[model samples]
Each structure stands twice: as structure tokens, then as C-alpha cells.
Target: MSSSWPYPRWIAHRGAGKFAPENTLAAFRLGAAHGYRMFECDAKLSADGVLFLMHDTTLERTTSGRGTGGDQPWHALSLLDAGSWHSRAYAGEPLASLGNLARYCLRNGYFLNIEIKPTPGLEAQTGTAVAHAAARLWEGAAVPPLLTSFQPEALEAAQAAQPQLPRGLLLDSLWKGWLETGLTLDCTALVCNHALWDSSSVLQAKSAGFRCLSYTVNDEWAVQRLLDLGTDGIITDRIDLFAPGS
Candidate 1:
């Protein structure tokens, strides 16, 4: 990461960190209410080629809809109650398209970090579509959303589709040559599980010019530790625990 990068320190996970329906517009609003100015979300294309927010391979976990999310067309996916599973108060929360989410973020002046959660065998297509959509949506905005993915093929597709957009590589472990892989993809940051990061890892990533962002961190001690290491950002589920002004 550059010494003068302009990203916020705190990022909300899957919208409001599981308080609201993950990946729904309702979650984004809830997160904003909790003073989160930036949010992380998963993006994938439905069978009909429309981009929507979802973190799982199947709809069984998060939606009232049936079947694998990747196998459903946009029309079917849109009709699913993406929020009811979380809470009845959010019963009608519709699946959010990338275009819709981008518009919301731009209008509200919120930053976004979109994780390309492509379905198996659709990695390249999903990445290209999401990146292309983001580029078009944020064409005139002050800042475009950041893109990241665990799949290198997806990141490559995204990069090829929209060279101007910034990207990050998401990792769960410190595999051999992880740094090299990140560099190969021209990623601006390395997004990893919080537990996988340590002082040495942070220093190595920073020294190699990659911003370090740890995910799902909710503890105050963890936050302080990352800050002490000069981490670029922390993505957390506990939005109320680390408000923007706090």
C-alpha cells in the first residue's frame, strides 16, 4: 500500500455485518445508520447474466428462494426474499444488483469493496461482468469501488475487462508465493482473514507495496493491533463497535 492511500480505516462486512440481510440493500442502509461509510459485499452473476449480491453457492442458506444461486435466472433470483432469513422486519429485501448497489453508494458518498464471489466454472465471466458493471456505474463518481476476489482467474478477468479499476486479492492463508501471486494480478491490496495476519506479514506486504486489509475483525484489541501495524483497513461485522467518528 502507498503511504498516502485514501481509503477509510473501517469497512463493514456484507453490508452491516450480519445484523441485517447480507448482500441486500437493506443491509447497506443499516450499515450506514451505524456510521459505516464503506462496506464490503459479494457479487456474482445470475443465470440470466444480471449481477446480484450473494455469498453462498446455494440460496438455501440466506434466502427463501430454492436452488443454487448460480443456476437461477435473474428473474427468479430477484423474486427471492433475500432478507426474510435474517429477520422478518426485513421481509421484502430484494436481491441487489451491482448496478443498484453502485448507484446507492455513489449517491450516498459511500465507498465499496466488492468481492467477486463467482460460482464454480463461471469465474472469468463473473469477474468480467462485475467489473464492467462497476466501471460503467461509477464512471463519473468521485471514487470507484474497489474489487477483490479469492480466485485469481476472476481477478485476471476483471483486470482485463476494466484496467482502470483497482483490485485486491483475498486470501485465507499465507500460501507459498502469495505475494508473487498478488503482484501477478496487479492487486492494490491483500485482503486476508484477520487471524492470518501478524506483524511480520503486515510488514512484508507493506514493504512490497500492497495494502493490507484484514476481515471480520470485531475485537477492540485486534483493531488496535492492526492499527498499530499501520494496516490500511479492517473489514468487520460489528459496525456499531467501530463507528466512523469513533
Candidate 2:
């Protein structure tokens, strides 16, 4: 048999995404119900160093709060209604911690892509905290998480904290020296905005021993394009629409 790639090619973005409050347990359940074996979520430290899930720095968009999420300790932040903003069906779902989500995924044998979304000016510290926490949480697992980040400092810190766990560098634009940066950071994958990939880009990355992944691809054309380029992973918000197993 061929070697087993630990991650699935299809990853559910922010759990089930628009179907539920992003970065909540409800979202993860929804994604799993839709047959996703792999999920992606943003992680950041609370004021007290608790690793919780929230995409934006502020809670205005995704939670029922008005200030910076990373500014509050878990005792306060954990109680905020992270779901009502999405829909009443999930009115009071609690903000989930990385440990909470980790238990669910580990028990069910699911894979994860943890994007290190640090608070402003805390990139390296946040990366170090999340990496250390993940290393502890996922101890003895068959496959570790694929840590990723757009911030170079965060990925660099993650590498320093836990070099054994694989990592990916997220990119929205193919900035100059991205290849060298990914190599320098020792990333196993390059996760990009879907439109960034083409024949040469994919070949260039693959030739350097890096897997190419794309994010938030919702349209059929985008999916087809990534498939054509032999992309390794496709992180999407359309878990309800995409057939994960197929």
C-alpha cells in the first residue's frame, strides 16, 4: 500500500462555517455530520493564555461581545454567546476552547488544521503557546495537526516550540520570497488563496517537497482548478455543499 497522508484533501473551514457560528462546537458537529473527516479552525490565546477558537481579533462579528476577544480571560470570554449571531437555532453555544475541540476531533478520529490567529503584537508568544498546548493535547495521536499562519513570526515561533509537528504557511498573495520563507520556516505545505495556484506555482512548490493547499474555495470552477493543479488540500466554508468523501 502507498503511504498514508494523514490529512484529508477536503477540509471543512471554521467548522461548518455559515451553517453555524464559526469556531464553535456546533460548527464542528455540523461539519462532521456532513461527512468531513478534516476541519480547520482559528486558534488564539485568551488574556490568561487559554487557547480558544475565534477568527477575528475582535468579537463584534462572530460573538455577542464588543471588544477584543484575546483581551479577556477564559472565565469571561467563555460565557459569551458565540452562536446567536449566526442563527437562533444555535442561540447559546459557548465559545469553544482548543481543548474542547481537540477532544471531539481526537475521539472521532478527525484531522485538524489549526490556524494561529494571534492577538496583535503577540504573534510569537501566541504561536509558542498554541504549539506547546497542541503538542500536549495531541500526545500519542496517530496524526498531529497541521499548524498554519499568514504571519511569519507566528509560524517561526511554532517551529521553534515544536519542530516535530508539521506546519504550513498561509498566503493570500504570492509575495516575493514566499518560497524561501516557507523553506526557512520548514513548512511542509503552502496554503494559499485558491486563485494563487497555477501549473508553475504548483510544480514549483511540489518540486521543493511542499504540498500545495488552497482555502475558502466555494465555486465549482475553483475546485476544478485546484484539482487540476494537483492541490493537496482544499479548505472550504461550503461543508454543506461539498461532498467530503467524494
Candidate 3:
């Protein structure tokens, strides 16, 4: 690890992803059981200004609830069954709040990569809300969670809200203006798609003082490629496949 870099090399996607119902407490516990020290999960706001976990704009995919998740308050969103959609064993699991996750991860010494997933037309609001909430929740901690987003406006809002917390710009492709956008946002790192990094691009980003990371890297070939490039971090859904600190 670099001197200024203070995060794990491997981060569990949405807290164990395919292994457990994602974004729930059960998923985080499962990730810990699988020996993951750092986890990546999505964070967005509900109608009532509460920070909660949910990846999609609608809840039908992960939770039993339907329609827009951000339209409902925490009181309604928390009671829904967020786990049963995956399996019967995790049937009654309820949605967890940002505070709940913070307490659990802090108590057990785990790191977090919080992806600010905003609802449509509310990107800036969601990013600022999540950042402020994370800053408050992680108060007095030695290190704060790394906030990331594909939306530059959101990341900019996060930077404005809490400059102390580190941020990363997520990119699915090497757009023409991506490097400038990340630098403009004052991000500490750039998280890109697995295939986005190569020998040349990795060197360029590193030389420019940007830590490069890859996401959704679940295969051996992808892992080897990233390892060869000396990428800073890897987020994967295959929690059981690649052991942390290996």
C-alpha cells in the first residue's frame, strides 16, 4: 500500500453480492465471514432524508417493495423484506440504514467503499446527503469511507459537502473528458471498469497522481491483468473466489 493510500486491495461488492442478499446486514455479515476486510455498497436517500442502502432506482429487484425507492421514507423502506428475493433462508431481513452499517462495520474494524447512487434528477442532493451522513457517522474514526460515483455533479457536491473524506470517480469507459473531470472534482482515485486499465493507461494515471481501481473483477484473468498493472483496489462479487490479502 502507498503511504497516502489507506484502503484494502480487495473490496467485497455490495457486501458479498451473489453470495448473499446485497445491501442488507446479512450480506455484510456474509462478507466478513468470507474474510473480506473492506466492502463496497450503494448509498442513497429516502424521501424522508434518511440514508439507506439500495442499488437500483426501484426496489422490486432487490426488495419486495415496488416503485421508486427514493420516493418512500425510511419508515416504509426499512420494514420491507430486502433479502427474500434471493433465497428463503434470508427471508425476513430488513433494510439497514447508513448508521446501522456504520456501527456494525466500525465495531468489527471493517472498511467501506460507499458508492453514491442517486435517483434521477437528484444526483447532487443524494451525493451531499450521503457524504454528510458518512462524515457524521464516521466521526472520530481513524479513516473515513471512500466515496465514489459515476456522476461528476454528485462527486462535486460531495467534495463541497465534506472535503475531508476521500472520493473516487467511477468510470465505465475512458471518456475524453474523464481525467479532467476527476481532477476537477479533486478525487483521490479513479475506479474504472475491469477492462479499462492497461499498461499504458495505468502508468499515465499513476504518474498523474491518481490511484487506479477496477470494479466487478470476478475472474482469474481479470485479476491477473489488474495485478500486473499494480492497480490500487479491486471490487468483486466473487467473495469466496479470491481471498483477501492473498
Candidate 4:
């Protein structure tokens, strides 16, 4: 049997391009409309312990709600207009919970890369909640979403809670013994910022039998370079730039 990971080359960032309300179902649908079959989203826990899609530490930037996201209850967070900040046309777009996103993706045969964006002190809680929720949401599906995080503690907690789900370690830059850190967390892949990858890094990850994926690549030349270097996948914000056949 082949032991390759199943993932699409083109993944929409935070759902669609940044042109839409990021992390909203609307953004995901927009990407899908543009022929994207895979998506990457940020997952975090609300004050009441609900796992939801969000990227920032606070709500001021992405939503009408105020204060830190970790300090607000789900009731308050859910009511905030998460879309209006992006554009007036997207006014009143609601926050999407992890459960909702999982259902949407699974039902549509879409692949997902769920990045665990836990609040500083709530790594364990966020990991546990996300894993458990994913386990429940994707029950009986053909393929489960890939869980990932930059936080080692969060990945550890997620592994302990749900070992069946695949996990990846996200890195902004490589540090001393980065391979050891990935091994410690039992990651199946290493998702890094685009500029950090080179032929040596790709070879090292391949030698370790781990998939290498790069994020936020939007240019044609960069994509071509990554492909030439044998990257397993490219996570891009320019969803319209490439498709299954293009």
C-alpha cells in the first residue's frame, strides 16, 4: 500500500482570499466556488470553552466584539459581527464554530488543515477541545482533517486526546533541533512559512519521512520554485491562481 499523505496542492488561506471575511463559512464557500478543494483555518477556544475558527488574540481586529477573545464567553463572541470589519458587503457574518466548519468540509468532500491557535495559557484546553470536537464532527468520514499547531504543548495534548488524527508542526523559522521537536510531538508533517524552505530543508524532512508544506505563497514564480524543490504542498492565499487542472 502507498504511504503517502492525501492533501491538495492549492489550499485557501483562512477560507477564501483575504478579500472576504477570514475564517467565515462564506470565505470557504467563496474559495470552493473558485475551485479550491482544500482549506486552512485557524482554530481557537472561546471563553466558554467552545472551539471556533479565529486567528487573532483579540476581537478588535476581526470582529465588532471588544476585549481579548479568550476572555469572552461564546454567547458574546458568537453575536459579534466577524465579517463587517473586512468589508461593508460582508456585514453581519457570524463566527463559525469548529463543529460547523468540520461538518461543512466533510460533507463537501473538502480537505482541511486546522491550525491550533490557542490562547497563551489555554494551549492544553484548546488542543483538547479541538481534537475532541473534530473526532465527533468527522466521525465515519473517509478522511479526517489534519490538525496542526506551533505550540508543542498543544500538539502534545492533542495527541494524547486523539492519536488517530494526523498532526503537523507549524514553524515560522527553524531553530536548533527542530527535527527533534517534530519527532517529540510525533508530527506527520512540517508546515512552515515559505521563505524558510530550501532544498536542504526539504531533503531533511523527506529523509525523516515527514511531509513538507509551505504557507501563504501567492506568486507564480514562488510556487514554481517550491514545486521544483519537491514541496509536498503549497498553502496559498491566491486561490484563483491555481486549480485542479490549472
TM-score of each: 0.96, 0.97, 0.98, 0.96
Which candidate do you rate higher for TM-score, 2 or 4? 2
lDDT of 3: 0.91
- Candidate 4, after superposition: displacement of residue 51 in Å? 0.7
lDDT of 2 by residue, 1-246 (tens): 112457889999999968899999999999999999999999999999899999999999988888999899999998899889888999989999999999999999999999999999999999999899889999999899999999999999999999988999999999999999999998999999989999989998988889889999998889988998899899998887789873
- Residue-by-residue lDDT tens digits, candidate 3, 1-246: 133988889999999969899999899999999999999999889999998998999999999899999999999998999989999999989998888999999999999999999989889999999899999999999989999999899999999999888999999999998888877888889999989999988987887789998999999999998998899999999998999983
Error of 4 at 144 (Å): 0.5
lDDT of 2 at 23: 91
lDDT of 3 at 229: 88
- Cα lDDT tens digits, model 1, 91-153, are 988899888888899888999999999989999999999899999899887778899999999
Poorest 10 consecutive residues of model 4 by lDDT? 1-10
Task: Assess candidate 3 and give its TM-score to the true structure.
Answer: 0.98
Angstrom error of the Cα, residue 47, model 4: value is: 1.3
* Total backbone clashes of candidate 4, pairs 3 or more residues apart or in separate chains: 0
- Angstrom error of the Cα, residue 141, model 3: value is 0.5
User: Which of 3 and 4 is the better model by lDDT?
Assistant: 3
CA lDDT of each candidate? 0.89, 0.92, 0.91, 0.88
Candidate 3 ranges beyond 4 A from true positions: 1-3
Give the lDDT ranking, best first. Answer: 2, 3, 1, 4
As a whole number from 0 to 100, the lDDT of residue 137 in candidate 1 is: 90
